[model samples]
Target: MRLRVEFTTEPFDLDEAPAHALAAREVIETAELDAVDVGPFGNTAEGSTDGVLEAVDTLLRKSLEAGATRISLQVSVIGDGNGEGGR
Candidate 1:
């Protein structure tokens, strides 16, 4: 299975990127994923189910440890690798 994950860590800092945000970015960038897009408002990654799950786990822990008060995340099964529909 394949998954796509979108997430954000807060409290936001308009002046610069927060520690939590930087942590999240590092997790995604180094993870075994594809289609990575990171930005101030949100971030996204797509990969195999196991890869996405593992990355999410690390992201949550690191971001919170870096002082993120809240995290908003969404995950979706995008495909089954056979060109079939997802649930």
Candidate 2:
């Protein structure tokens, strides 16, 4: 069960914010039945559904931890192993 996640946060620059986000991603990638590989950096992460959900949770937590005022997230499930990779 794979899915995609797009997340955006309130604008505020913190020196360690991106690292916090990436750390969250790393945690999600290896947590449970999860594996995450980032796509191009336009606010998208695509992978297993469980992984995606976990990653989103991580993202929200990290964003809050980083002092984000707002967090917005979108999710889209990739093709159902339909041989196209949802490209």
How accurate locally is residue 9 in candidate 2, as Cα lDDT from 0 to 100?
62
Q: Give Cα distance to truth, residue 34, candidate 1, Å.
A: 0.1
My TM-score estimates for the predictions, one after another, are 0.96, 0.60
Position 7, candidate 2: lDDT: 61
Give residue 2's error in model 1 in angstroms.
0.4
Task: Report the lDDT tens digits of candidate 1 across residue range 1-87.
Answer: 899999999999999999999999999999999999999899999999999999999999999999999999999999998877486
The Cα error of candidate 2 at residue 28, in Å, is: 7.3
For model 2, which pairs clash? Answer: 1-49, 2-48, 2-49
For candidate 2, give the lDDT.
Answer: 0.59
The candidate scoring highest on lDDT is: 1
Any residue pairs clashing in model 1, and if so which? none
